[model samples]
Target: MIGDTPPEASPSPDASVSTGEKTGADVASAHKPSQPQSTESHAKHAGFWALALGSIGVVFGDIGTSPLYAFKEALHAAAGDGVTRPEILGVVSLALWAMILVVTVKYVGFIMRADNKGEGGVLSLMALAQQAIGKRTAVVFTLGIIGAALFYGDAVITPAMSVLSAVEGLRTIPALENSISNELVLMIAGVMLIGLFAFQSHGTAKVGLLFGPICAVWFASMAALGIGQFIANPQILASINPYYAVKFLSEHGMAGFIVLGAVFLTVTGAEALTADMGHFGRWPIQAAWLFFVLPCLTLNYLGQGALALTVLDASQAAGRPFEEMNWFFEMAPLALRLPLVLLAGMATVVASQAVITGAFSLTQQAIQLGLLPRLNVKRTSETQEGQIFVPQLNTMLLVGVLVVMVTFQTSSALAHAYGLAVTGTMVVTTMMAAIVMRQMWKWGWPRVLAFIVPFMILDLSFLSANMLRFFSGGWLPVLIGACLFTIMATWVRGSGILFEKSRRDSVLLTDLIDMLKARPPHRVPGTAIFLTSDSEVAPVALMHNLKHNKILHEKNIILTVDTRNIPRVHESERITIEKLDEDFKRVTVHYGFMESPNLPKAMGICRKQGLKFDIMATSFFLGRRSVVASATSGMPLWQDRLFIFLMRNATNPTEFFHIPPGRVVELGTQVSV
Candidate 1:
């Protein structure tokens, strides 16, 4: 359980090979510039259609498709075979309230406030937590990795359930239904799921363009349906009143809890809106949801309730409203039905794409933080650095989703496993948020409690409901996420211990140079660049270099390549060089998680800084250590093994750090871990 992906899982992306020490005031030479350059600039094009579709494609997948079966299952849970009309409306009303409170008020309105830079996932929040509770960073990192893993679970289940529910709608038309068996429906869904992931190998730039307009149409159609239903029965408007939600809660306490489990389905994908903030920017997503998506969704849910009241027999039709309610079909002509089906299918595919993108982003951050093994990631678009494609992740996710579609067969059965992962993510978010408020913001206890209490209540309600799904298949995802979390924590601890020991034995550059002056020159080297791990220290290789040669290079630069938590930083912020006089320089390079450290490009930038260096005159020195650890080495055996594996499997810095292959020299130092 060290690193999110095992070394065997995938190959490292571009930066996996960085190994050089930075020292002196000129450490700026070590910094690598982030690329596909445009991503560095703010997105200026007001792509309303892309924003609309992308938000819909990404945001609505889990919740948009919930209406297909949420009420049916909740009604069954509440009253079983003898369910009453009032009970159905009550649960439906609860579902509406949960969406308004959790998705609309909490996530869209509030939790979005806690974004870390442009990043908005649980890990980003954990970074905020680190700023808040410095010494207690471990706790926050643990929560983040767990929350991240659970999202993978959600990723697996959301597609299976969404597609199944839509295909299940085919059962409504008796003539059309006879041509499509349920098994056929499941198989078709499985194939579509596979195809959706397969298409991911090709970036979603074009597909993402199609997402907004289709989702806009889908939402508008749903709203139109709701308005029509409202025109028939205005009393259904009461559900929109917060009073009705409070009434449902006060009147039915224990029953309300079970209702909430189903109700959570309405807000399952709420996290996506914030998690994908980096790709779309905060404003576009906010504008799309508030101005377009939310109102339409509210109208549609209201219309469903209004339509329910007009029905004379609710239980006889059970969950299949299309079959029981003829007026709804009459409201839409036959020509529109096929287009609606196509739109729905496309919307689900977009939803899948969003989650897939989220998984990639999460994995990227994990690698940068040393929690995950490096993976071979390729930039899919020249214009968009953020748009990346990871083949291994795409394949694994596709297989997992299709397997669930095959296993569950029906969306309803899959629903039992859906909400738990989302709720778990929400729970961890709240925990990380509390830590952020207390530690980073320096908020008083009362203010922290005031902010966190409501979140805790909401998260606990959903998590408790999801707990009911444990025997129903909730445990599988939690187990997967737990395994991932364990690996991340293990690597973090291991890396910390190794960093500490490396620093302990490190020799100061000044001290080593003084000793070399006692002797004489042995080799021809004008400038030597050595890489160090901890940005503050000089690498031990400097001591050995001078001790063996009995001479100092005319110019010495200690370069430390630092990977920061944020996805991006200003260029002015990139190179912080400290000149340690006596012909020595220390350079610290700042890189965002989203960027790759192309060393040759960094060297070009270094040349631009007026640093005197000859490509032929310089020698790149790297401390290549074969790390070995025993019980006495201060790190646990598991962690030691984990770090060694991480080092062995990591890409060689000669390739990753962009050093001239022939000029680069590595000196081996055997160390007890």
Candidate 2:
């Protein structure tokens, strides 16, 4: 019997196939080059400087803005003992090394190498890792979902914290201090956030053109301010040494350990470098980090440290308190402070934009991979396929950002909740990278341990420090991650169960075709396309149509859309057609997890292959399942209910697959699971 397996299903290791007969394994093997040959050529075409500039704008926004609040919060957290020179050096050291170890070594050096068709993200890496292991393991799947969930939590907090911190600089300006109240700051930040999200539907292609130049100017400003402070006091450069970091830990002990949470913020956006690698390419991101973003951030942090040290010295000499000074804002001169505030505000807005777009891209990938319910995904660019906007996700993110802004009220307050999500994602990325090194890269155990152990220690230490603030505010992200993780896990589990249940009751395609030939029903004169998840079984909609309508179309097509692990499928390999009999044909359409499915466009391609498609004469049949939670279902009662809710809320197949509403027929059926 001829059978077409679903892309997500596990394939036999030794399955044999003839020239015409291709199994799921055969198709996957044909595409799995591990490292595509196009990676180098693609990187070359973009040019190094162009890519680096692009990376600075899109990839470094979150971390680049860390100079605004990270150091200030660290000092505030350690205010119990009062600010000292060694403490200042120690905090700066921690921040610098965190960037070096976390961003430079773990992500840019190693994790970025595990790209799937030059696409890098937690889910993309998950697909690559799973393929290497020869099957999907529960551990890898959970890690991917958890990483993705934590990313969403970070997404919610970043816009609120970044823009709020930047705009709060208004209060620091003596001229605007009395005019801008906390309420006013919130109003402005809220407006900026709303504007950002509102502009998402129109897409980022045009605005993105300006991000590079604007971010370049922002980073230059950061460096200039920092350099001015550094030139005034060269002693702060000593913090670059690891000795201060060690002395800090030795002197303060547990208190110093807790400060790591704030320091972790210095590298919060490091993950973006890898996640956005596909957009800018690896060399450009790496080059931008090493040559541009990293240097600017380091100098800024050093300058902030130098300024703090000078303030502490003055306070000690004059017998005053050190609580009044915020080195980040103090670094700017009185005359330029207002303009600096404006620049910082724009930079933060850029930071927020990157994360919001990332959330949209992640949602699209999750939905394509079947880990999420279908959402309305709209492409924003004609040339850049990755440019997309999900309206539902944008609205939810805006609401979440505003809620966090209102509740936290200040960037310092929001900082506590921020580290948990960022650190959690970093730790997960480290773990996934370890798996990739061992399974995909085929590194020796010793080599893997050497590379992964240090990163794990750093990530876990940061995560543990953030956990100390759980009661303070860290629990917000934990709560958010838990909820999102549950949703993703439930959807994946529910879909698997439903697929199995549906497949069990389905008639085999070979058998159905043979039966139809022997006892044919009344033949209708138009083409009919039945969309099915699995091509081996007859579509439920086809069965329902035959059962009730009592007629078979003159030409029937069983259509199955399979999402591959790669980022995209070439047009030549996009559609596979099999003839079971002259009256019936089984067609499988292939898409990548990063690509959207367009049934009409795919059908047009099919037309070139002798499969005729007439929009007016052809009808697309889809099965609309009304799912109910049953006590006997495999999932727990709560999860079953959640799955039912998600299923109901999911976008209709007609809209999701781009099938014309006028030419589509949906047959509804109740299914208990």
Q: What is the C-alpha lDDT of each candidate?
A: 0.68, 0.84
lDDT of 1 by residue, 570-673 (tens): 67567767787767788767676667666666766777887768878888888777778677766778777866786677667675566689988787777776
**Which lDDT value does model 1 have at 614?**
83
TM-score of 1: 0.83
TM-score of each predicted structure versus truth: 0.83, 0.93
Candidate number of the best TM-score: 2
Worst 10 residues of 1 by lDDT: 1-10
For candidate 1, the per-residue lDDT at 529 reads 85
Model 1 spans > 4 angstroms off: 1-54, 59-62, 79-81, 133-136, 229-235, 242-255, 310-336, 435-444, 536-554, 581-583, 616-621, 624-673
